[model samples]
Target: MQFKWNYEPPTPERQKAAKELGEKIGMSPILANLLIQRGIKTESAAKRFFRPMLNELIDPFLMNDMDVAVDRLNDAMGRKERIMIYGDYDVDGCTAVALVYKFLQQFYSNIEYYIPDRYDEGYGVSRKGIDYAKETGVKLIIILDCGIKAIDEIAYAKSLDIDFIICDHHVPDEEMPPAVAILNPKRPDSTYPFHHLSGCGVGFKFMQAFAKNNGIPFARLIPLLDLCAVSIASDIVPVTGENRTLAFHGLKQLNQSPSVGLKAIIDICGLTNRELTMSDIVFKIGPRINASGRMQNGKEAVELLVEKDFRRALVEAGMINEYNEQRKDVDKQMTEEANSIVEKLESQKHLSSIVLYDENWKKGVIGIVASRLTEIYFRPTIVLTMSDGMATGSARSVAGFDIYDAIKSCRDLLENFGGHTYAAGLSLKAENIKEFICRFQAYVNNHIMPEQTQPILDIEEVIDFKDITKKMQADLKKFAPHGPCNPKPLFCTRNVYDYGTSKVVGRHQEHIKLELVDSRSSNVMNGIAFGQSAAARYIKSKRSFDIVYTIEENAYKRGEVQLQIEDIMPDTQKKNEK
Candidate 1:
């Protein structure tokens, strides 16, 4: 609710580069401005961002010792040695495991898959997983989305003659895991150009390398894009560089043609043989896949993605639906509990942050809760679930705050942890919870400016009624498949006439629909606000306020275009001014 509205312009060189690229790409002024704002100034950078080419992707062998990894994997295939895939328990991890297993199955049938129990073995390659691979006569183990910190587990696997090739994106510790080949881009000495691929993306690169080496034609890789695209969009990785190429093309596969498993799930989501959008994946598709892992065992989710038969996919769909219900219930309860914590903390003058630890809390939903709490409170927050004398939790933070560095400040109290700047996971002794809480708070206080720690909507421009047009939507779409580094453009409009009443329209008033019109030509755009029933009052009161939003296909019955309201403010000057 209290955003600082931080807006800073790009450097002159970056702007110049963006202008040149914009001229070359034939982008609109608005889209070009957005591009310039995001640091894509050069012709090459814009080409990569807008029209990502599969050929431009770095050679998988360019990754440190990737040649060794490929050689080891080929050796496993040649010797017919059993291989095991160890991955994290989240959707990204599940998807990574599924992708790797699917690709490796092409070369050899002796491949096995293993996902660590969120409660039992925790994140990354674990001794429990390694032992099972060993028991099953596995000679090669590949770690996906995890294993950057599995020094001990990697050592244990080595002792059992289980070689490991880690394909993870998490930050590695000072001392790396002694795997057969480590494929982490975060490695300081690594020369890989891009550093933002999700775990699934990295795993896809491995498949890409294998495919290219085998000369297994390009069309073979298309089927896998649906899974990779879903993972890329769902995991919230920055959509730039090689990630741009993967997600842009992957989204096409999801909409055009997907695997049987994906097709089944898409049908279940009431979308099949139809054009799909990021909204479809993020809201309709991804949550269901995530539900299988969060509410039920992650194995079910993996099975749903890997299943071939339509009948079996249907069965998997039913199981996924059931798990989604349970996941929703858990997410709702955890969100309420987290809200209560925020209320209590604020009531006690302890700030609006939420830091609660419960031994009984489910490990699977902590990250989801952390995400929800951060969005609700718009503050740096932490959610911890304790178990067996230890507390494992996730942290989500606002902009201008580095959660990883903050966690690092209190690392002495943590047994282990690693993640990116905005989100991280940690495990610590139960006794250290208080120390961590205090130390983390101290770190936050020392770093973040009072005004800088809020959910500020940086606006692209303030436009009048005449400037917003139907053609604008088509032009804006050049920046399609937008994500992190390349964000959907945010615009502000004011002095619009609200034609009186608002309705709670969608299937139980699940959303708010208010009729608003541009001053000129009476070009009415139905402003639909999802999950915002309270916003009707603002429109009904003849509130002449500033509205910040994106133009989206609020396709009513199919053809009507509308403005999707993201934020409503009291005045235009207040919104535009600092």
Candidate 2:
């Protein structure tokens, strides 16, 4: 349970530049330095960063094949062809399906949505789904969130006379699918301005192009931003560029006037009284939506999402909430069992990656288990379970590691695999599990940086207690909808001592609620250190310590700031070292 504090003090030249820029922009140098690190050097860029406007979003047509995708959709609608909306079962996929289905359903009635059963059909463009489309006389399918690697499946659908328009954001293989038009910013030939977008984000852009082509007012598209924001947050995509604008406005929509389905979920989560943030979606909202997919069928999630009646949506949300409870129970059990297995590994300390296989493990929850193992072990980890006589599983990676590539390196052993840099899904013959593990582990060991296998707290800046002002707090608040690339800034305060009122809090006394002061000022800052009560004795000894933390609004006291301390260590230790 140790963390490496990562902070490099600004050089004098950079400090001078930051100060000059701060003066030019009428802001603090620390805030300016943070902006500069994010590549916002000029005042206008900083202005745009803080207040990203909707009109500034990149033109949807700039994406490769966007015109073709739009034209195909227009042709389908004009001919009144039976259209089927399809997506994966996860939050991003469900949201994509819901966004496209809800938007198109307003003007068209010949459309239906499909979410393949995770257990029955597995992931991506399943053969069963294509057969269903064929059976139902559907002529076109708009598959979202997953389809980049579905070459064979798309061809199968094509043979069935069903054309496909794929809207995905995953890294694609060299050979593309035989869809009518594939819309992915990561495509090799893509000229899209932004490279990172969630699956739902891609679907939103497709709808945007469709709206523009049909002369539909842009205001009509605003309501769907809530789904886009949920997907962006849940999928952990970068919250910069076009994503920032979408998430920013999406959050406004979520807080001010959420869709009926989301409103039902909000009320169920007891968040109806407060403004929802990205964190709320990640921790509270997204999981509930995903639970339906994990515990049962994801169709329930899409049904709830696109439901028009509040009463019906509320009923659906209640069922989904029950599923979430079930998911939590299974996840806890699986994570504990996986940890025990890892603890028993003979080469636990020397191993660079983890590959655990248990046929009895639930396939739906292995992804969560893999994530937990990666966070705890600080290594690329894969958790596999038996599915359809194959060892199928989910892979999660440490920071700065590419898990998808690691799995791709063992593609010969894998029957199918696809994902992003940090997360992926793969399946291999049960007999190949042993070989896959050895190769995957060796690849990780050879490529992963030594420091990448350790937990690190990346401090954005070092600032004194006195520098935390109302204006600085407000400026930080403007950096909303924070995620992967544009994260909530983490600040380091060196040599700060606990005030007399600092004491253990929490039901089990596992946290420290702090009243702290620094040597430079008498300003006592309130902070909370979760799961750090082990440091309470030293803190009470009046010993100063360095703390790395992110500033957050005090939940109990609105408008007041609280330091959510991430890591704490004695001040005498070597600074900023692993």
Candidate 3:
């Protein structure tokens, strides 16, 4: 797929200021430029960004209802109340439950955890989960990663004499649940400094407050950060502010001294010798952790996360690995089937959205399929399957589109729907599927701009090949743990010629390996464009091109930096336009 490169230029004043700051800090100009681009303009901001200290974390009591949540937990613990840690089935939820449950276990043994089965209890707070709490004689329930929208469920639990402390991070509806304390920063009345925390991050903050109130030093809770980091990475939350600090420290803990379960997973994935990055967790650890809930019971994932013995954790990790393999196979097959359905649609070219449904589709993998479909269709996409006699589905949207709003427009047909701007989940009567698809397409067609449908490569700046250097790469390393809002910088180098050594190099020759030389400086650099073998033809024709890429150290060749090409376009400005 081709992308429109959107160049972002820094102001001259800002550039000069950053350069001066870099000189003061004894760093390179490129590093300074990148830092300034990320809003780290001053020496103090640079120090905070590069060396995130745990003490820099905001006080947990500042969050809305945080003190009340802590008081409620203390009350439960003092009375020896049976407290249940309730969470959703995904990684964020499971990790949240594990983090809180394990922390509580350190002082109290009366606490237990409950992860509702995805197949039986769709998502969030459910009657089955509440009923389980009642059966276990639980007096207090700590709801994590969910329950912000469970007004009715919370009411029902309250009726059963159960109190709830919600720690969700999703966008909440206007009518909040009557929990003892709601710890979601997204709450309109919330005063938390950072609002983009993951579900587990909120749970971590709750524990932080609890530790402080109980006279337990906050430093003692640092070991729980690995779980928080996994949740942040897996949940796709913005890695900025407190989230960055948590993820940074959490990743260090994960690399240096991970929990037994995380260590087992790292070993099983053959990553024991290497440091794991956010991408590694997202692709390697996250999926395996999620596969348990997607393919089987989420309780297994929580169990693995809470396991204390390395030997037992390995056994559990092995079982989870098998589930992951099964998940992959199901996901691949369903995606292919969804693609074929899109191909067979006669109006596919004119349609503003892609909506497909299959009765046989496993609900577990439909979300993955919806995301995969968007890569091919590049529009608001929904993949639905029959679940409990209802048409249940997951919706994925383009970059600028509000999929939740579009889905909301069809609320008349939906029994329930909730999520954020880019992704959402919904279920409706089987007969409403056709109407929902038609109305959804109409809404997107009217609201989505033409350019919004096309993929966009957000280039941070345009730079010469000579600007790429070992010092620049070293300085960029300080920008550890990059994600939304603070993404790795993408630079576009224009009018670069690929040396004759350029060749297609991957197992299927699907990647282009090129030695590029800047037209202005004659500086050479190695560039690799994965899944871009088509670009080899342009290289073979000796065409000058503009390439958007991120600089990375080529680990295989020690001490060598290379360009990881994001997109390539022919040098069009040099040619006369029509």
Highest lDDT: which candidate? 2
lDDT of 3 at 391: 85
Give model 3's clash tally: 0
Clashes of 2: 0
Question: Candidate 2 at residue 56, lDDT?
Answer: 80
Best by TM-score: 2
lDDT (C-alpha) at residue 161 in model 1:
81
Cα lDDT of model 1 by residue, 1-578, tens digit? 54444345556765566566667877655566677777766666766666787777788877887888888888889998988887877768888988888876776788878877766777777777887887899998888998898898888888888898999998888899888899988888888888888999889888887777878876677778777888878888887778878888888878777877888888888887557876678888888888876776677888878887988998898789778888878888988987886777654244535577877778778888999988877767888997656799998887667889989888888998988888899999988898888888777877877665566787776666566666676777667787777777877777776776567788877687877764555666677777777566666777576677787765544445577877766554465675
Residue pairs whose backbone atoms clash in candidate 1: 17-41, 18-41
| Clash pairs, model 3 backbone | none
Against the true structure, candidate 3 has what lDDT?
A: 0.89
Per-residue lDDT of 1-578 in model 3, one digit per residue for the tens? 97877866777887798789889888877678878877788898899888999997999999999999999999999999999999988899999999999998999999899998888888888999899899989999999998898999999999999999999998887789999999988899989989999999999999999999999988789999999899989888889999999999999999999999999999999887886899889999999999999999899999999999999999999999999999999999999988898998989789789999899999988988999999887988999998888889999988879999999888889888787788789999998888888899999999999999999888877789887778878888878797877888888888889777889998899999889897878777998999999778877888798889989888578679989999888756336331
Q: Work out the TM-score per prediction.
A: 0.92, 0.98, 0.96
| Overall local distance difference test of candidate 1 | 0.78
Query: Residue 343 in candidate 2 has what lDDT?
Result: 89
